[model samples]
Target: MPAARGGRWGRLPERRARQLQRQMQAKEERIAELETENAVLHLRLAQRLRLAGTAGTRWREGLPQRTRSLLRLQQAAQRLRQDLRELRAASADLLGSCRDQQQDSLSRILAAVQSAQHHGALPSWRARALRLEQSLQELSARFHRERQRRRRLHNRLVELQGNIRVHCRIRPAMPAAAEPPDPVSHSSSASGDVAHAVDDETVLVRCSRPGHHAVHKTFHFERVYGPAEGQAAVFADVCPLLTSLLDGYNVCIMAYGQTGSGKTHTMLGPRPPGAAQADTGLIPRAAEELFRLLSEDPSERPRVEVSVVEVYNNDIFDLLAEDGCAERPGLRREVLTTREGRKAVSPLTCLPVGSAGELMELVGAGLRLRARRATSVHADSSRSHLVVTVTLTAAASRDGTPEPRSSPSPPQAPSCPSPSPPATGRRPRAPRRASSGSPGAPPESPARPAGQVRARLQLVDLAGSECAAASGARGPALREASFINRSLAALADVLGALAARRDHVPYRNSKLTHLLQDALGGDAKLLVIVCVSPHRQHVAETLQSLGFGARARQVERQGGRGRPAPRGPR
Candidate 1:
């Protein structure tokens, strides 16, 4: 019985061991399955992380390009989202890098789209960028064009600036009546009183107060035709300037008037040579005064140099020089500074004079060179402006006392020591003519010495500034009138600028203005002599002159030594 029981225990033990082995196999199979699943999951995660790192590297490499590519990808994803049904229905194989890669890229793209949509910039950003590019291109083009335009404008302005001085003198007008009588009473007196009034008027005129007409006469610079009687006065106010010239101040006296007025007579005198009556013009009177002053002061004898020039059609010509020399073509205008540091032109030719007879000869030579033409207003009217300048250079001591060197010095020595009349020195080649059929060229003259202290007394006789209708001009005369009017208008502009005190005045706009710039606003003392007719026909011209004078009184000048302006009138 013991042997049978031991056999049963052994069988039971074997059966239990078989059951335990089966249990161990099932646990091992479960463990193997978990390891395989973990391996597959790990492989997928590693692939995704590698792809993300690659994408990040690409993003940093070229941000603008990568951003554009990413934007395109986002657009594709958006299309997929919008047409999900079509994407799902399409069975054709889609080119996708990796399932994990697509999923990760799609997720990032979706987030960006959502953010862009929330910010309201997705649709308009592309349009805005395109517009910005176009605007940059346009701005670049405009910058180039404006730079070129400014260059051209600057060049043009520089070319127009020349050296000249211009001044406008208007004839003075009579004062207007302070108050007019009642219109009704004036009309009644004119129409109601006729023949009986005429006979009574003669008896009343002779029997009434003998000085009644004189008392009624009003002294005026302009003409007033009425029952009043007054003597015609000429240059009454300008006499002071004439006197000041002998007192050592450089003076410029100009007479301005219309044609058929007394301008020529006042400046040149109406009496012809060898006439029965001796009539003297302002020129003769001024010359006589200068002579008298020189004779009175024998100790302070001055050497006077005179130059006569005419500015015709904006061209300068010297009267004393030969006609061909004076009328040289293509001479450019240039400004020069005197020893006193005054700026003026160097084209004027000067000649020394010792007596009044020599001055008269010079004046006659200038008159012959002046431009004159016939108009309905006058048979022989001056068509150009005449400028007579007398320069007096004085050498004085430090205390303003006359020195021995003040007397006229001998002619200057030649710069080259008078080289022996071209022993082998060939003559200089002549300049080529501007065009065919031109006149013969004149001989070249010696250059004048520079850097001389000169005080100039100028007398200007201006041509008439008249309208075509008033002057009855035709053909060439009409053109001349137009030019004259245009120059006058330019003068008016200069005066207006001076009156207004504008910084950049337009003196360079016209030759006339350039020529008179110094006289009008320079160191010289200027006296404007306005000549007006005593006839009622000249009322308009007189009024115009008076207006010019009013503007002239406002001109301010740079004082000598760069000092402040004086307290009195310039």
Candidate 2:
């Protein structure tokens, strides 16, 4: 039934149905729109979700880096706090140190103030010290005076004993030869102190050999000279002996040694023009000293006369004789006995020496004469023994004292006019060195003695004792060497006898001894300069020379008494 009804209605409502279906379709389309809108909203929401997720992932990755930065800032803040704490502590320590230093400075200042407060007593102490120094000075002055007095007394004592004193002098060794193969043999031994000076009084000589034990000897003397010593040193020790001559004493100075051992050099010294006055030999210095001493007291000085002689081949020749200068040729011998048993040269040119210069001239003249014609070991060698006499006689003065005759109006001696060449000497016997007499003066008396203080100072340069074989001599030089050795032996004998205090001496042994008889035997002060070569090669001759010195020393030690010269008018 319902179906029939529905069909009937359906047929009647076709138009209406169509309209209602359209309405339905509209409703369906609306639904589809709603679904599509929803789908679109969902797609947009998914895209927003994807973007938020990516932003969250980025935040997560950056979180650790930010955390690490915060941690580093915290650590830096901690370090800053630590540094401030240390600064605070250091400030405290510096304040404490300053306090301590201030206290120390205060203490030092207090100490200085206290010292200054106690300075009132220094003046008294200083005054006391000055007084003590004054007293000490006075004592020193007194001691000096006493020493001087003692020295004077001792000099007088030594002068009174007219003994022969020996002084040894050692010359310096010259440059050695080119180094020899065996220098030990030519060299001085280690024990060369055999010539060593222990003091002013003692000398030691030590000897040693390869197979033999060392042997030594010691000698005593008044003075000794070493290689380093010079002429001034020797003269200093001898000055006292010279002073004795001024006090009215006879003095004889003799130099003896072997050939080439400084014998001539010690007496006459090196040739002039090259040497100085202070370094001249004993003879020149002695003359100069005489003039100086006389000048000190001219009113009391004695008249001086000089004569030079030479003993060649045991024959005495007057160096200032008239023979060589005036044609009275042959050598003049010494007159054996004179007025008072004295020795005098027959034709001695007793020239009056006014000054030291004149004395030097005479010496030069005598040297020239010696070199004129001579045979010698050395060209300038003194082949003959030289004897220079400086005779002093007291001249009358207003006060009865001695006076040196200064008058230049006296005559010349050994008259020679228009003298020859350099070989001949000028008139040596002039009354005075500065005398205004003729150049050709004649020989005259020795001197006019107002008082008897007759003193003869003889400077004897003995010919050296050398071996003939060593000298290479053929005739005259060999003969001269023999005579020299003989005369030296004679001298040694004389010294030995004097040392033994014998009653008689062998004065007649040789011409030299005979000529010096009076000066040797009498109470004459004698000085011997024993010159020696400091060479090992000269050991033999050195021993001989030293032995001679020893004997001479014995003579003095054994009381070789001397008589002072007569003090009154002759």
Candidate 3:
């Protein structure tokens, strides 16, 4: 009896559903019938209207009958319309119930599926996801390793090529403003162009004599820039050295040439007013690049500081200094040697820079204070050798050590063969870099203090080497000229000693060479941009400049011999 009762109870809901379904079907059928009747009535009314229009008086005879017929049709339509509304309401209710039932069934299905997944399939899926995550982590680690390897290899390639790179730039002829000053007469035509860039690596100087045969001298360097090449072309060769600087290496880029030979133009771009934005020089571009690189690794917030100094009259003046002397605003500073043997200038002002704009503004301010004098060689000659040093210190990690992200261990410099014993006075050794265990292995370095991963980008615009007679000067200007010539000669002597691999390099022969001892004799990467005029009148000075650059290319820093410039066609 209990079984029978259970069966009846279960059948009750099925019976009710069947009854509701039957009622819904009946309502739909009734609504369809009403719609059909309404359509018939509409057609009949149209036909009657057409008859009325065709036979106006004739149609009036049966007007009463037609009116009665129309009333009956209207009443029928009204009743059918009421029935349609009722059926529609009933049908809507039935549809809502059906939807509720479907929704309940779907909920039950979903619950069952979820239960199955939670118990049986979830663990397997979770394990597979974990494996994928592990694989991704491994891939990321491998990628980092490969990236570090590539950096090492690239730096190695650069070192093998040459640490001291010499590039020759033949200044193109420009208007009178940019030309060398002629004290003789204003009637002379522009100086004839004698120096020509034969190719990317060769420069040919045509020295034509009045009566004797014309002589052509070919000079080679790591790179050569033609007059057609823009500033971008020159910076392209230099851009890579910035990477080296960031990777924990000291870099120096110096422009050496005669006055009015475009050294200042190349290093700092053209001075304001007339200069286009596109002609921006190396210093600003380098600052922008440094900030760009720092932006990429936002986690490592590095600090950059800039110090501007000018070597004037054999004295180093801190252009950024705040001395109260209106006559000589730049405060004089002296170079000191640390216990580590590195050359440093104490009490020198170092302004911290946040962005490229800030760096440029600071540099611009310092440039305004830099000493300049008008001479026969250039209208606005840089009387002093300007050195703008940008120092970047790596951010510290939580443990107070150098951050690994921004401060990777720099590759070890190539082992230089020490040919002879040290001289009585040896210059301080260059700051040591992290030594790599092997070529392919990651660099292994001792734990260094925070900010120890510091590198310097020294942009030097050397005072042009000039002949005292050619660059006419009276009292103080003549004295300045004498000092400039002496210092440049001292620089030449240092390079000659380095090229000859002599035990004693005369870095102390002049303050100019003393300040640049690390770049010239140590492991720092050095790039000399030898700027020369294309004019025939400056042939002697151009040759002298080229000879100095040639000597610079032969002096290798540290372990390896200097890479010779690629010889071009005669």
Candidate 4:
């Protein structure tokens, strides 16, 4: 069995080898089939991958171009956004400017509409009315433009007709009980009613002596006011001058009369309790009118200053001074002549005033300090000359803003000397600050800088001229009378000199005349209101005053212009 096992084992080994070979072959065929199937699967996978890649490539075709296009679109969109931002910015700017223009245009249209409504044209639907309203609106605008020119022309006309205008006023006859009996003239009538206003322009003085024939004298003046004439009537003629004042002209209105002739009444109006608005005097009335005009256009916001001075016993006193609440003899000032020949007062108290009432209060305060004394001719008489000067300063700005107040400095000379005359319709500009050390040039005032316009309104109430004997003067009264007479004589001399066209006018002869040198020299519009009592006792003074008025009428002066305001942007 062992031998058989060995042989069988060896044969089995061969058999095993052959069996292994067949098994190896079968496994190879199986491996080859598996490899083919695996190769087919690989081919299929490669095809699928190629197809997927091709489809993906086809789907992704023009990706760079599309990306570039998208980038371009984004850039274009960004540019559009930028352009839109720029357009918005531009529109904002345009709108801002247009709004400003529209605001101005709307204001003008509203004014026109209001004017149309005022004339009852707004309610009318008729074509004719509409056309008329349109024409009226146009005319109104034209009139507004021409108004300033008209003012210039009117002022020129006033200058041509004599810059100095004279008016005469007759006071009513005083009660016999009030008049002192004339001891020297016993033959004279008890009631000395002699002066009378014959008409609106004529004054007649009728005097009859016992043995002499009746003597009648008539004087012609610009206007004559009877005692019956109200203050309104007298102011009607003087009202036009206020307009000239606003046109940058210096104006002076003075009252001249004998004692007790009603000058105070006419100038200051009825005293206190008896005084009504209708009976107010020229000073208050003028103040009212001035403020009224300024109120019409508050944008201008013109500045007004007031200074009051009194000439008492040939001495000038600054009534507006700090200690000048009452008649303080120490509150004296010196009148100075500028290099430009204009009069100025140093250390003058010039207070700023806003309204007419405020200005009047100032005036009233000054008047309280004015010199007054009782005389035989009247119970209360003005013993001094009162001068109230109102200065109007108009400042302009390049940027249309209010000017800031500057530090205080010495005031400059107020005279303007232009190289050439202004155009026909244009107003002259305000005086400019002069160069240092130049002729007639003073140091510029901090309050008033360059390119500022100034105008002055001087109101004067002169003390009465009376005979010493008639006034029953003694002691100080006699001295006052003498000085008064001398000043009156000097005034007459100055007027005569002006009338005769004398090259040398004695303006320094008296303090009164010297103080009013500018007004008398024809640089200003001067209005003289001559007041007289309608009584034979005062006939001599009346005649003298009338003669003075006549002389003043003959005095012609060339009017000087103040600086014209600058025109603002329309």
Against the true structure, whose TM-score is highest?
3
Query: What is the Å distance of residue 171 in model 4 from its true position?
Result: 0.5
Predictions in order: lDDT: 0.53, 0.67, 0.75, 0.75
Q: Give the TM-score of candidate 4.
A: 0.65
Ranked by lDDT from best down, the candidates are 3, 4, 2, 1
> What lDDT score goes with residue 112 in model 1?
91
TM-score of each: 0.49, 0.62, 0.66, 0.65
Question: Over the stretch 1-570, how does candidate 3's per-residue lDDT look in tens digits?
Answer: 999999999999999999999999999999999999999999999999898887897787889999999999999999999999999999999999999999999999999989878777877878988999999999977976885676677678778768999999998877765565544334332446789999989999986756546768999998999988888888888888887776667789999999888999999999763477668888888888888987876645655777888888887766655444433234566677755466767655565667898888878877776778888777788888899988766655556534533333343323232233321111212222222211111011122343345667889999988888888876877888888889999999999999999999888878889888877887678899999988777888999999999999998766423321111110
Please write out the lDDT profile of model 2 over residues 238-293, one tens digit for every residue. Answer: 56666667766677888988877777777877764457755578777788788887
- Model 3 is weakest, by summed lDDT over 10 consecutive residues, at 436-445
lDDT of 4 by residue, 271-302 (tens): 66255678888889899989998787655666
Candidate 2 vs candidate 3: which has greater lDDT? Answer: 3
Regions more than 4 Å wrong, model 4: 1-144, 183-191, 211-214, 272-274, 324-328, 399-447, 559-570
- Model 3 clash tally? 2
Query: Backbone clashes per model, in order?
Result: 13, 12, 2, 6
Model 2: worst 10 consecutive residues (lDDT sum): 435-444
Rank by TM-score, highest first. Answer: 3, 4, 2, 1
Candidate 1 residue runs with Cα over 4 Å from true position: 1-239, 271-278, 324-341, 397-453, 534-539, 556-570
- The CA lDDT at 36 in model 2 is 99
